[model samples]
Target: MSAVIEVVSVINAATGTVFDLERDVDVHAESLAGSRETATTTTGRRQLTLGDEVTFRARHFGLRWRMTSRISAYNRPHHFVDEQTRGPFRALRHEHHFEDLGDGRTRMTDRMTIRAPFGPVGAVTTRIVLAPYLKRLLTKRAVHIKRLAEQVG
Candidate 1:
């Protein structure tokens, strides 16, 4: 079974600016500093574009993990999709959407679908634990991006 998590954030910045920050590897690293996350591949330090792949290393749930994901779809300041090629999860897909709310505000939505590795038990644990954890992580990332984008905007 696959667990899905969705998060929405409203930023007081332009959609384009927020979109750029979402694709910036450095900004992402900073936002996830608590996890000591780092980019371990060639595209880790650069802004992600279509077909770009980045490998990330981080400590989560007291365990270190490495995941490599690629930019599967990109539509400029509107939306983008990234899917995991290798990771702890059996499968993972994240979609980010940005909407212009007018008057310098943007609504960002993150939708994720992830399947854990342990079959039924993994699915149960994902629903009880991992899903909420990921939602919080996404929330924190969005808040950080909002602050940064507002400062620049």
Candidate 2:
């Protein structure tokens, strides 16, 4: 079974600010510092755009991992999606959405779908273990984005 994890944050910032922060490669590396996550893309830009492909190297759960993902969908100041093209997981997709609250505030949401590879065993493992761990990981990242975005301007 594929597991879906969602986290929502309301931030006192413009949609553009929050959206840019959400897609900044530097911010991502900084936010995942505990995991020592580093991201690099062939395009060599700090901001990710549609069709951009990024490779991530990190250690999680005491295991080193490398994953490559592409910005599959993008709409500036609104929403974007990145899906794992190659990774340990059978499948992974993350959607980042920003909704303008019309008062310099934005509602940002992170929706992630994760699937494991080993059929029944993978399903159960994802449901019982990976899902919760990933949820916490995403939550921490979201909180970091909120804090930094709110501080901007």
Candidate 3:
């Protein structure tokens, strides 16, 4: 079975503005508050588009890893999805969603599905990782984003 982790947080920023922030790859990296280190192509464009290939180097739980992903889906100021082309997981799919809370706040959710490379051993890996740990990581990331967005204006 594949392991899935979903985390949601409320960002005290306009829904539209928050949505725009997620669309820019650089912004997303920055909102993580230096948690991720990235490099771009010769074009030097930070905004992401459907089918764009991007590479990211980030540390999670003190473990540094690199991921090369392609933007599998993009739908303007609403939601976007990315899938890993080359990385640790046998399969990795991430979906970013934004919802309005009717008070200038945005509810942002991250849904991640990962299939570890070691087959049944991956199931054991998931158990070891625990959903709560993954949730905490996402929560920390959201907090950083919330602070950044709220402070921007």
Candidate 4:
């Protein structure tokens, strides 16, 4: 079974600024500092664009994981999609959407779809453990991004 997780965050910054921060590799690393995540390939510290691929190394659940993701879709400050080429999960897709609130704020939403590796057992584990863990991780990342974007604006 595949698990889909959605996380929404409101940022007190412009949509463009929020979108830029979302694709900034350096900001991602900083936001996920607790996971010790790093961009191991591509334009290491640059913003990701369509057709750009990045490999990330991170420690999760007491294990080191590596995932290569490609920018499958891009549409300025509106939305973008990243799909995993290779990763710990059997499959992974993350879609980021940004909505301008028309008052210097943006509503950012992350919709992630993930499939585990071990078939039925993995599906059960994903539902019991992975889902909550990922939700928390996503929440933390969003909060960090919001703080950074707000600070810069």
Candidate 5:
């Protein structure tokens, strides 16, 4: 298992506003410029729905990566979790959370876990082959999300 990555940003926006917008897949896709796409998942789409699948495709370091993730857990106006069905790593889980500091600002956090193959060998391989790619992806994603959220605020 690889080390999990967590990134956070404080947005000058209401918690409720940010929470509601984040739950709407279409709105999220538009906000993030079509990085995520929603469809009729086998389990269906509902608030806090589990097993509902969604696909996200984006460019990272000029390489296109796609993830078909399932909605595993959620609590409206607070947190949601998604696990990847397809991607580079052997497995991936991502959780999005929000906090209200009572000052009209929302703190958004993203936590991601990835399990790579080959165990120790994979770790070494990743450091050499995938680490840079993943870093660039995370950096680009953070900047994009920050810009999008701030733009809406």
Candidate 6:
């Protein structure tokens, strides 16, 4: 079964700043430093663009996990989407939307669709465990991005 997680936050920064911060590889790594998450890009690029791929390795649930994602869609300073090519989930797609709210503010939304491995068991696990864990993780990341954007915007 597939599950979805959506989180929205208003950032006191311009869309361009928030958008760029979202795609900054270094910022992403810093945001998840508590997890010891590290990322390596296939092209060694600091910023991710359409068609770029990045592999992230982290200690989650007390075990090391690795996931590779590709930037499948990109519309600069507006929105972007990344899909997992290899990860714990059977399938994962994340959409990041940045809406210009004038006066140097932006409304940022993150939508994630994930499918677990096992069939029925995965469904139950997703709802009871995985979903909540991911929601918290994503929320933390968003907060990190917002703080950085506000400081540097």
TM-score per candidate:
0.96, 0.98, 0.83, 0.96, 0.71, 0.98
Tens digit per residue, CA lDDT, model 5, 91-132: 887788899867778888877777777889887776675656
Off by over 4 Å in 2: none
lDDT score, residue 118, model 1?
90
TM-score quality measure for candidate 4? 0.96
Q: 64-97, model 1: which lDDT tens digit per residue?
A: 9999999999999999999999989999999999
Error of 2 at 128 (Å): 1.2
- lDDT by residue (1-153, candidate 6, tens digit) is 899999999999989999999998899999999999898899998899999999999998899999999999999999999999999999999999999999999999999999999999999999999999989989999999999999988
* Per-model C-alpha RMSD: 1.1, 0.7, 2.5, 1.1, 3.8, 0.7
Clashes of each: 0, 0, 0, 0, 0, 0
Distance from true location, Cα of 4 in model 5, Å:
1.1
Question: Candidate 6 at 137: error in angstroms?
Answer: 0.6
Error (Å) of candidate 5 at residue 33 is: 5.9
Give the alpha-carbon lDDT of every model: 0.92, 0.94, 0.75, 0.92, 0.67, 0.94
Q: Candidate 5 clashing pairs?
A: none
Give the clashing residue pairs of candidate 3, or none. Answer: none
Candidate 5 residue 115 C-alpha distance from true site, Å: 1.1
- Ranking the candidates on lDDT from highest down gives 2, 6, 1, 4, 3, 5
Candidate 6: regions farther than 4 A off: none
- Number of backbone clashes in candidate 1: 0
For candidate 5, give the lDDT: 0.67
lDDT of 6: 0.94
